[model samples]
Target: METNTTSFFCLLLLISATVTAFLDIDELRNIKYGIDILNKPVLLSTQGIDKQLSETIDVTSKHGQIYRCIIPSQMEAEKQKEEEEKIAMEAGVPELLKPMESGPCLFKTRDWWSYEFCYGKHVRQFHMEDGRIVGNVIMLGYYESEFDWKNETNMEIKSRNKNRLNRYHSQQYINGSKCDLTGKARRTEVRFLCEEGTGDYIARLDEPETCTYVMTIHTTKICHHPYLKLPSQQKPVSITCNPAVTDQVYQDYLKE
Candidate 1:
């Protein structure tokens, strides 16, 4: 685990909690259990599964504030690592501790769709629905690729260097546990991401001892969802009569 990264995040969380308390919503959504991020709404998660994504990245021999990349002293770096590890292990607690899915699921996608995007630099600062006041989210990790877009258009990603690949890192964030996007305040999530390059790790470095870029993500609801709680699943449909599912057996059944 990147100890400095932990300290950095803890600082961010501390500020967030204070902000949450000050704002004092009716009730914060308790996110529990490892969940289907895209398929399901941000509800809750338990402790992490047996093996999960690494929350740590080797920021460098030195770690710095999330808003800026400043290397810490070696002695300071070591101390920070231990402290960060403690907090990460504690905060890394999965809402639900279970075996993750076998196939690439919610948080996972194909490489063709996931390619190197604008890496290295990102935005912090999230806005409350009322843009007048800023929300507590100090920094957010932003990342985007054609992965989700592939379903929309027929296209492919071409990566010459591995540094442009979105392979290891997963974008995770605690968006406002519940947001009132709809007419009623709805549960919300402020997702964060890290930027990773597909090129050789060594190639990315100007100096071997020092680290390169750290990615921060930003997000906003494009249009108002208007108080509808995100649905966990769509109504079960008759796939057999989907017309698109015209297998021989289905066709025979249709005839019958």
Candidate 2:
């Protein structure tokens, strides 16, 4: 069952097995378009009504770098700025309270990535505090072998039935199928984890194939929002991931 009813969305999502979305202003503030919205043919019939789902996102940019500004809340665009001023003054001009890698901005949207199926759904926290982002967790799911398939040698002539089923028997009735599933019945594992990136840029930003989540989770070079640098002489800027989570997770493949 679908929950969102609006015809418009401000979240980012991709089509197909993939997800895609857009950031209206900064990486923090994005307009996401999900498959469900497009897939839902029912909502398109709305006549002249406007629907919206808004969220607040914290944006970050390099100290001396140039980036676009974002409107915090879609419903009320200026509230964020007003709140920031109040926040800055209350802190007594302290950088800690006003520590910013980039100007604090709000994100407004007619749509949001409410579809839990998409990668943007895991945008746990998006904030720029003190030139860095803290506690941003991006999650992804992938398949792995439960058994150590890589370690297996070859076919095993087990004591079980030895007839290969796919082949036709005398009448092609297919004798009680039997054969060594030498390379079959692998023990596989699926894993999910949160990645905390403190680098400058995310690798494979487009098709982050390694992880299921597409939205970038950045941390400050020190500890805030994700940091990214421009290309150097040879290589482009890159972001490194700090395992917010690392465990045995599950064995990709094992020999049962």
Candidate 3:
């Protein structure tokens, strides 16, 4: 009886350790905590089974707003499939089964695209949408002459913007949160939401940085164009624009 009790306790310890280890890894891969200011529709959690893709990421806006955005989950894919099937059924047509397409199935092909903003300097922004969640990453190349890359004060000011672009452009203000800034890392996390409308609502950066800024902009216009090729898949191209030219070109693309 004594031996059996000892073995049972050992088994329990092993099981506890295994579960703890699994949770640790899951927590590290996904952003289990924090709120996305962009008003993305998905709940924030690290419970997703897919390890290849992350469910949440930290983003800093051009004006230095930091926030977390949730990535689409495997559950979303299942929901999309079911919706498609339901549509087919309603149309009195048998749903055709198709092989799952290889590659990261985050957003619809029509909605996944990228573009470069070239004013005095160039910045690249990529938008990836999967259902209601949209992931955006903006890369601002380093300029050594402007300021020292390691300057803390400069970095802070450079990352932050005083004016709220969302309101200026007629977007409704939503909730937002900011994370603490620490160490030599010029990074912070903040998020907020703005009312989306029919206008082209592209997140813009006023100042360029050597570091990257990311955000998830929730809007229906994200996937409005079906024919526009994503910048990654297209040949090398550049768009040179002033403020007016930029607006015109972007609007024209949407019309197409």
Q: Against the true structure, whose TM-score is highest? A: 2
Candidate 2 regions off by >4 Å? Answer: 1-38, 43-73, 76-78, 95-256
lDDT digits (tens) for residues 1-256 of candidate 2: 1223122222212111211113344422233322211111111112222223332112112232211112223444335545654553343311321232253322212122121111111122234446454453222221221222123343532111133221110000111112234322211111111123433332222223322233232323222111111111221111111111112211212211
lDDT of 3 by residue, 166-195 (tens): 311111111212213321222211112233
Whole-structure CA lDDT of model 2: 0.24
Q: Please report the candidate that would top lDDT against the real structure.
A: 3
Cα RMSD, model 1? 30.4
Badly placed stretches (over 4 Å) of model 3 are 1-193, 198-202, 205-207, 214-256
* Worst ten in a row by lDDT for model 1: 220-229
Model 1 lDDT at residue 163: 36
Residue-level lDDT for 187 in candidate 2: 18
Q: All candidates' TM-scores?
A: 0.15, 0.17, 0.15
RMSD of 3: 29.5
Compute the lDDT of residue 55 as modeled in candidate 1: 23
Q: Which ten residues in a row have the lowest lDDT in candidate 2?
A: 166-175
